[model samples]
Target: MSGAGNGFPVPDERQLDLERLDLERLARLRAQLVAHDCAAGLFYDPTNIRYATGTSNMQVYGLHNPCRYVFVPAEGPTVLFDFAGCAHLSAGRSAVGEVRPAVSWYHFIVGERVAEKAALWAEEIAELMARHGGGERRLAVDRLDPAGLRALEARGIAVADGQEVANQARKIKTPQEVLAVRAAVDGCETAIGRMAAALAPGITEQALWSHLHQANIELGGEWIETRLLTSGPRTNPWYQECSGRVIEAGDIVAFDTDLIGLHGYSADLSRTWVAGERPAGDAQRRLYAAAFEQVTRNIPLFRPGVSFGEIAARAQRPPERYRGLPGAALAHGIGLCNEYPLIVDPSAWEAGGVEGRVEAGMVFCVEAFAGEPGGREGVKLEQQILVTETGPELLSARLDETLL
Candidate 1:
């Protein structure tokens, strides 16, 4: 994963093969999908496709690329619908079972490649399913947009929303995946040292991020992620990108950033500080305090038999206010994705409906004051841990407080 584009250098770790993660993930996904009565599922989300077919294809470009869809028939095997000659995908350790590189899209339309390919690709998904074991097959679709939904509907395929099964299976971290996440966080923490080392008054946020970027590249940590080297009031915010703002003397700077490890696994971590005496800025102090308090509050809830809702209910703490910020829950999640199930914002973990618990061997980001969308500030907690028999195990050793 060359951090150069952000963190790891050339000869980077991004190239680290994900064969092991792929196998475990695929087996898990397959078992879950079949068990759910889904005859076949079309995965268009890049992450899902990668989980099934072992290809980043468009997921790597991050914001760009319209995404490549991979179809895995429950009765049959998995295949990818993309551009020319993707048969090589079958050659990898995490190989796809089949490849359908659509030719019509090549001469079909310009600027609308993904749309065109998707249109034609939807037909292929239907045809492939039919050929394998057609008619009322109880199909499922992952990440379907309006257009894609119409196309699948027209095909007469009974497509059900497949993300639910996917989310449940994906939330738990396999041991291999956990190890990879730990490695990624290690890279993030390493990059943090580099970012802090170059910090000082008069240094621009862009300049410090550049320093952090360079170190990540040199260390083979691909991508700087969110270079939030903010000062003072900005620290009380979200992933505010690097501005030309200068870190004046006595001001604070927080570099809430990360590096994706060699395995394409991401590490979302943050570090807050100042250019001068590292004054106990209310925002930083409150976040750290909330994080510590919440993590301590939630760690016990992570056992094998506890429900996520139970943990959420019990996670309340001392209602301290910082810069008028009220006290909040601590401990967020860290995994293949930034899925914080403990704080079920979008993913439904209501009382009695959700029985999800901390299974042993599951990896988590215990950055206190964290979890889900619609969360209060001071949630940029950044610790990573693994669930164990004794309890949640810290993977990234808690470092010395980097600031005074």
Candidate 2:
């Protein structure tokens, strides 16, 4: 636990406030939409809807069903299109100007189902736009079924991809958002500490993994976003999900706690530890040392106004022996989920890389990995950060370097 300390001077749990949404964030979204020239925004992605409207109901269900959505006019108030009969919930919890019943998939019977629903939805959307002085103006959408898109077009509303605008709005953290993310990371660190105290040989990866999940649930976390917990050979190539394979002595156990925790923000941190009480063998120490170096070396480079591509160019590679292991980007933005401005290897910069200059209030995860290509084990490490007016602040706590 050396290089990166907690991103903020976190208060104890009893004194900490974890509420995530506020009028300020919603205001920021409206401003971004206007700047993008989006007369109004129609958001169907569950996360986008949550960001724009500050309401949640059966979110995972809504993700695939499209039963719930949000409509935000750039210059006026926000509106939520929740499932029928659920307006009260939105009214109770959201800052929206109005709550309207949307066509839930449950109501589709058979004949002309999509057409009927789309027409109904379009009518409401058009009325809302017209009320906001945006008659026949552009409607940016994050996700919409083809039937709905065509219906909006038929209704004379221009539809375009609004995901980037949503990302831009959410990229910078409000003060409350920062506090909420801090609380999430605190919950995550507590869960990880529990796992470390309970670490031992013969524990199944499933059982070890459940400790974090249980702790997160108890701490008011919404969900565990990934299943990446593994040990031994499964740890080398990366992305191997947790299995029933029993951890053995001297094995290296690694996991990315991609947990969606308090206030619906994410705490995405990774750690690798040696199984059992004994000290690591030579190979374990070698890989772990390399990973530690790669992670710690880059934390200072994420200052305000720094270029993401420049950081990518200077990113430390896996120690020479582990050069070619398959892995994702070295790092990416984290909020409700891995959001934007992915920092990748410089070699891939020209091939669809997202370029941007880091700014104060931007949160990023710095990642590093080490393994012999096609070898038995590897190490993965990541640290959450907040780029500030001064410099980068480490949001995540220090890892147990002794285990590595």
Number of backbone-clashing residue pairs for each candidate, in the order shown: 29, 2
Candidate 2 regions with alpha-carbon error over 4 angstroms? 1-20, 105-112
Clashing pairs in 2: 7-394, 7-395
Residue 325, model 2, lDDT: 70
lDDT, candidate 2, equals 0.81
Candidate 2 lDDT tens digits, 1-404 = 12224232222444333234657678878888888888888898888887877777887777677788888887787788887788877655545788877765334433457677678778888888889845647988998777778888997888877898899999998887887778888878878877886789999999999989987887777788789999999997989899999999988999999998877889999999888767889888888888888888888889888888888888777666787876757778988888987888766778857788999999999988788887899888999999889998988888567854
Global lDDT scores for all candidate models = 0.60, 0.81
RMSD of 1: 5.5
| lDDT at position 167, candidate 1 | 72
Candidate 1, 214-296: lDDT as tens digits: 65565555564455566645555455677898878766565555555445566666555557664655544555665556555
